[model samples]
Target: MTLQKKVIWITGASSGIGEALAYEFNKKGAHLILSARRIEELERVKENCSDSEESVKILPLDLAETHGMNDKVLEALAYFGHVDMLINNGGISQRSYAVDTQMSTVRRVMEVNFFGTVALTKALLPTFIEQKSGHVVVISSVMGKFGTKFRSTYAASKHALHGYFDSLRQEVYDHNIDVTLVCPGYIKTDVTINALTGSGEKYNKMSKGHKNAMPPDEFAKKLIPKLAARKEEIYLGGAELMGVYLKRFVPKLFNKILKRVSVT
Candidate 1:
């Protein structure tokens, strides 16, 4: 469907895939509410977009601050009176082995990635139900589809999103609300650099796979069409997407491959 005049709220719009989505959606004449913890960066993203002064609204938000979710939703709705779509893209990653990871570290990741995202979505659900029309997009990872080394908490967080949104999709179907889970494989972003370590420190290193992954712009370009289609779920990536199918149809072989995979 055409997104002209569509009002979309995108979290994590300060960088990476979220930044790219902001530009692409703006090009389609969609009004945007750009959110992230960094207000300056959100302003930078807004300024860089076409017709952004009127088309984009910068709203600073920290995903971990779940208690303030209702206020944020109110502010977002105040920006445009209504929201046609909400993109939950702000999340953290893990780069350390689970055994070495502290419980606090795991809790932090879950707080930001899973609980925070769901909180925002829940906060906005009432509006959609009232309107009887809306779309929700969650930018999950291929890691959500299957487990791998050194990213246990991260994977669990993503997996929880898949389960939650899947059930939400079904429940909201009658309300005409679409829930889409986008499983992205390696995209060349700073995810690895900012990933959490065992002790909750930034990993500060790029991985071999990310070194040769798709660019954020291309990924966003490919994503809009899928979003317009209102797909229940879509996996975006190169060969890494094959793992989703392998895990589904060949569990034994998938497990063997996972042990040897270069997840770093």
Candidate 2:
């Protein structure tokens, strides 16, 4: 149940929450596989790990590319024979209204955030079931639970994840596989700056809320124990967590409040 000695694979490990989690998990003595599009950044993260030479590994992957992911799963298994956990953290965000967004742009975001994540998980499912032990950790956003302005595609992708994984969780429960659906609020990441616009270009600007949002490192610190406990669904953030409740209990009021809140 502890992270120590467990083989944990984290996608999007080059920066932000993924990078911070790499450091935190290394400190906890987990054998790590860090994957991302950038090899150099993965190398940098590995270099920073505790006893990294003996425990950490780097596997470059692009979530948007699914043809090679089954092979990537094999390659990941080759590292430690089996993976105890797969952190489905790799994804893209959008920052445009539906009316202004391109269909191609929306598909691209969905391809990365939903299809890519599902491809990897479905690829890894047999291994987990065979071993009778594994964890699927998804780093969804608060937008998954509730929609916001300028996040049409982003919210859709996240909502899709909740539906898919919630079903997957039930199906896998008997196989001793667990799923953790994490809805993270505004963590101080480059997500906003890296978010896609209507034309599929980067937004390149930080949101006002993200200016004082939770730090990724601090978030990583809080998340490890919850994962160890096998919590089914978790919402991690500050005041923004309230939106999840508001939307659920007082839909009319939440929609009115959502309009006034500046998401960008």
Candidate 3:
């Protein structure tokens, strides 16, 4: 269960939670495959690791390009010849209303957030089955459990992840492959800044909620323990955690509260 000596491959490693996880796992003496679309940023993150040159390998990847994911998985395995864990963290966000959002934008969001992650996981399944031991960690969101204003498509994409991975968990349990779904609430990251607008343009602005959210490093520190414990699902955040429980136990009340919640 310990991350020590484990070969962990992390997507979206260039910044935010993914970058923090790389540092945390590096501290635990885990060999890391850091991947993101920006190779330069990935290298920068790798350089900051404890033993950058020895323990980290930067693999530039664009999760939206699902067609190339199998090849990318091959390249990832080439580094250590095997991988103990795969973290699906690369995804986009939305900052527009459902009615105004373009269909192309919805497809793009789903492509990167849902399809891309699914494709990569499928590519790596054979290896996990062969090894008879591997872990899959998905970085989903609180929105996956419930919809909120300005996040219809983004929430849908996350909801799809929950459905897909939940099923995959059951199917892979006998294979000794564990699946963990991490639903992180508001965290201080560039997700809002990079979120797509109705017209498919970057929002390019950070929200007050995001500005005051938990730091990515702090969130990562708390998450590693849960991951090591092989928890099926864990929610990391402040009061937002309550929404998941409320939705399950008090659907009517939760729906009323959701309407008044300022998710932006």
- Candidate 3, overall lDDT? 0.93
Error of 1 at 127 (Å): 0.3
What does candidate 1's lDDT look like per residue over 1-264, in tens digits? 999989999999999999999999999999999999999899889889888778899989999999999999999999889999999999999989878999999999999999999999999999999999999999999988998999999999999999999989989999999999999999999999999999999999999999899999999999999999999898898898999999999999999998887788
Error of 2 at 153 (Å): 0.3
Q: Give the poorly placed runs of model 1, Cα more than 4 Å off.
A: none
On residues 20-127, what C-alpha lDDT tens digit does candidate 2 reach at each position? 999999999999999999999999999988898889989999999987889999999999899999999999898998999999999999999999999999999999
Error of 3 at 139 (Å): 0.3
* Candidate 1: worst-modelled 10 consecutive residues by lDDT: 46-55
Model 3 CA RMSD to the hidden true structure, in angstroms: 0.9
**Candidate 2 vs candidate 3: which has greater TM-score?**
2
Assess candidate 3 and give its TM-score to the true structure: 0.98
| Winning candidate number (lDDT) | 1
TM-score per candidate: 0.99, 0.99, 0.98
